[model samples]
Target: MTSLPLVFDAPKRALPPRHLADLDAAGRRAAVAELGLPAYRADQLARHYFGRLTADVDTMTDLPAAARGELAALLPPLVTPVLEQSCDGGATRKTLWRAHDGTRAESVLMGYPDRATVCVSSQAGCGMACPFCATGQGGLQRNLSTAEIVEQVRQAAAAARDGALGEPARLSNVVFMGMGEPLANYPRVIAAVRRITEAVPDGLGISARGVTVSTVGLVPAIDRLADEGLPVTLAVSLHTPDDELRDTLVPVNNRWKVDEVLAAARRYAQATGRRVSIEYALIRDVNDQPWRADLLGTVLRREIGARLVHVNLIPLNPTPGSRWDASPRRVQDEFVRRVQAAGVACTVRDTRGREIAAACGQLAATGA
Candidate 1:
């Protein structure tokens, strides 16, 4: 079993009141017993929340009516929706959530012909200070609680079930590519992942293989996550290949360097036997030069190898008033051609909800 460390690892932040989603089976039973309930009530509560996808205690019919309110204490609402916007004819939806502390975060739910995926936020804002990211510019607010992260998935699953994105379908995947660097808020994010992928009545029960966690190449965290033995996919935001340019682009590259980050990603891939994803946001003429593309391909080909990795090129979703802009389509196409030409797999990411600010931190940065 992947162990969960103490709640919020970041300094001095108050831990949110314990929600059932924050606890393990043993912890849940103890919480229930503290409320003067029987041990069986814990499983019953889990069924309603995880299996039935209902958070309203009144709807948990199997539990005694008298105890419903008491059980409800364990289900304190963690994420409250502020605004929801849909584009692509309602096939893509973005939600802004306000935490109890008034800090805000955002998540995006996108439905495709074959699957539905929700991009969830692990923090209210980011501290990475990546020049192009809205959240990074806004600065870090605080890390979200485990339950706060899990609630976004639960609601998205319910929305998909009710056909929020056209015909009803299972929410097939969850990506930690929303507002925050997921690996920075490591413990609660891992706890939330377990809650998402563990079997029903205990969790949302989505396949571990379907979850992807994105980070700006936090090397130690990458190595630590590799030891957890979970099958979740790892995505390293490597925007550029050379250390000199990456230092200005990713910012965190100054600390870990490009080679160190890629080496850590290689180790993670070897440990899990999964292809690591290298995320490159293609900026117009900034990091989009043909030679840089070639360097990106060569570096990955040497560091991560051909079969062990894939590069996902994001047509840069430029933030408001930012100097950054996405590369031209022709340039983007050529970049992919050059990368693939080096014998490593590369593909352009499908940009959904661009008009509605679907990119990470955009919606929440609106204070919507």
Candidate 2:
């Protein structure tokens, strides 16, 4: 047989210089000073970006006319919207953002009767290497800056306030479940959380309770997050109950076993007094077997009791060329029943954004 060459467009490795939100309060002051502006201007700029959620230099009228232009120039737009595709007639909008380095990521803004939620990406691509995920298939691109992440919320807020979704509304919730494993990008993710929940005239001022961070069970990261003193919900993506399957479904599980991961989650719950979210993706004839569900319920009830856990079952969203598919309705319902039977609260997550490649990595792959 003749030798063959394998080739494809190699993934981009380097991301652009860090955004302002990537820095902490002290770091922001240094950056502002480096820009030749007085230290006080850092707080002023933060007030505009984090508090007022505006990056337009023209609209930051609080600063001196001379300084506003200089400050804005230093902190230029970090995330630019490439496209906003809406499905369900203005109720759901999926936005594709092109970062400064041309790396693309996405976020979904959903408007409901009681709340408006935005699902934000922490990285342009994922490194977890999960076989069925759209983003994981793309490989790791780069971690997003804190400002890049916050800018997504700002844009969503702007859209909500401007009647983008029928009537002027406020962004009520934010979930870090879109692209990369948020805990893997720990530093920047925590910084973004601070910039998000900080008080008025300083940060976005969104309630900590309304923010949720999803991770693939990075144990140490989970424990550290609990100490941050922010009451945001923690969601662990526990696709399978046993280590045998999780080792393949979530590559990180290979490093941290199922028991270790669940223990970490329990510690977080105990420390934070907030119920941890257990996310399980049900695949037909795969992890959705009724026996597996029984085992899962046993693990949850034994490892983390009902008081500290709520299971959210996500039916697999079939990606192009993937062998995976969602479980049949009957199997799905039975799995839920088994878990609930074990006394762990369980419910099926609402499937959305399917019509527009709304899943995290789908839009980037299509655009590429």
Candidate 3:
């Protein structure tokens, strides 16, 4: 099959200023030295930002006034919340963030009884052109900077700490299943993940296992990520098990077929020992057929092994005016049954923020 004519690169746009989140330990120290500060000041700054979860230079009273002002330039705000919508009794909050360049991205913070999770965007918009997704239909804008991505998590974690989600829980999990195809903006996403999972003061200090990065089957990127040695979960958005329908549903399938994508996921699972999550959006009269469900189990079992994989079946969150709707409850149940009948683990995803458009681009669209 011919490759997709799609250009994975984002459109040209001016980027935001560099921030401390954009720098590694050594890089942060180098930056401080350029400002005539000692190298250890970088560690202090990190402790304030990543550890204490504050960017206000005023709150960093540990530093002399002059040094605080001098170091503050590198911490210029990257993401500003333009609007926020909440549902599920304030347990789920979605923020529409506008970058310094005025480009839009989004993040969602969901609170559970035991843990809180933040879903962050790696790009402002998407180029995947998945007909069922609001972000995909909106098309691509520019990619977010590394700090832009990290700030989303840092802010969400701080919000959770401050009881923005109620009951004051720690933000333990992060999923790159937000507005953009995370793997599309590969480098920044990986760097942001490192900054997120590293120890406090050095990074967010969250465990790497708490992080999950999803892709719509970018074959080469998947193989590359397997070698990163970061044990983050790999989630594959395999909306369909067959190529004929997938080529239409997920345009990238034109370039890499179902088997190719599954093989890459299998490789990642072997490399990381993390169970691969196959994300399938069950849409009515679309990919939710009984046979397709069985085929999904069979294909995943054959390609990625039943033991190393889990099926996360999502009820399609239809966009406004979209023709698509979620499958009936009975159909969804039967589909799950068939997949499980094939000896594969399958379950419906506990969808959050459905009333406020939990799908990534929906809030950004309204905020626009």
Candidate 4:
């Protein structure tokens, strides 16, 4: 077995000041008390930020003028919009955000007839170093603070309510699949998840089951999330089925291997009773062979069982100047056929925002 080097250090950068979204109810009360305001003020702040989805102190009319400003100063803004691009007739919008530290990250909002989903980044640039991905090729910038992550959702939720994506609909789903390896920023991502799923006046009130947290097979983090008792869906980006190829496609495969990742995913499925999502990007002639598809079906069924897993076949959205491209339609159909033939559920994922570079593996926000 060949050893693969792992790099976990994100560039040391100053994170933004703590915001109201970062702290829980208790912490928020403590923070308010420290500012010489009554602890009950924390609940008012929470109602404005989480329930009203407004961070502007002026909109919080229930609070006294002086107290509102003092509390707002303590929370501090985290995300500043750098650029926003929309496609699919304004049904899909991608926003590039510059954090207070000047690190850039992207969050995408996509609206379907039934639900609206936002894809958010947990880190600025990714450290995973997946050769085919635009974000991974850029290298790590820094982990996003919990408040920074939650702010993206708040903005998206507000956008949805404001009819930014067609009719006024609720932002119902969130996927941590934008620019970075989510589990690498474990603690903050978990905290953000709580803030996203908690009920109104405390957090975004999005259902935990509607949230999906993706990883490039971060084994330990997957196990840790399983123990957290939050029933968010787990998505493993297993670009290839065999270890030999996965080690090259998803470099983290070199550390945990394909078997280890599937086992951890199986444990997550059993613990959460939620079907694990296997994300396979079908790059042209790269790990898209018929045999690889067969192997994918075999291994998934063997390790995680057919009932507990579903494969999300992603048609590769090639980055600019990258040799990688999407597989041919016939090839993609055959691959799906093979996986389904193995008695495991599989479907081609709906590709969106390609014109605005918001598709899978295209979210590189370093320059935005």
Residue 62 lDDT in model 1?
86
Least accurate 10 contiguous residues by lDDT in model 3: 1-10
Report model 4's TM-score to 2 decimal places. Answer: 0.97
Estimate, for each residue in 183-278, the C-alpha lDDT of model 1 and write its tens digit: 889888999999999998789999999999999988888988998878999999999999888898888887789999999999999999989999
Q: Which stretches of candidate 2 lie over 4 Å from their true place?
A: 1-15, 35-38
**Model 3 TM-score, 2 decimals:** 0.98
Residue-wise C-alpha lDDT for candidate 3, range 5-47, written one tens digit per residue: 3479888887788899999999999999999999999999999
Residue 355 displacement (Å), model 4? 0.7
TM-score of 1: 0.97
Off by over 4 Å in 4: 1-7, 360-366
RMSD of each: 2.4, 5.8, 2.1, 2.7
**Residues 177-259, model 4: lDDT tens digits:** 98888888888999999999999888999999999999998888888899998999999999998888888888888789999
Assess the local accuracy of residue 123 in candidate 1 as a C-alpha lDDT between 0 and 100.
Answer: 89
Which residue pairs in model 4 clash with each other? none
The residue ranges of model 3 lying beyond 4 angstroms of the native Cα positions read 1-6
Report the poorest 10 consecutive residues by lDDT, candidate 4.
1-10
Task: Please list the C-alpha lDDT of all candidates, in the order they appear.
Answer: 0.90, 0.85, 0.92, 0.90
Best by TM-score: 3
Task: State TM-scores per candidate.
Answer: 0.97, 0.93, 0.98, 0.97
* Pairs of colliding residues, candidate 1: none
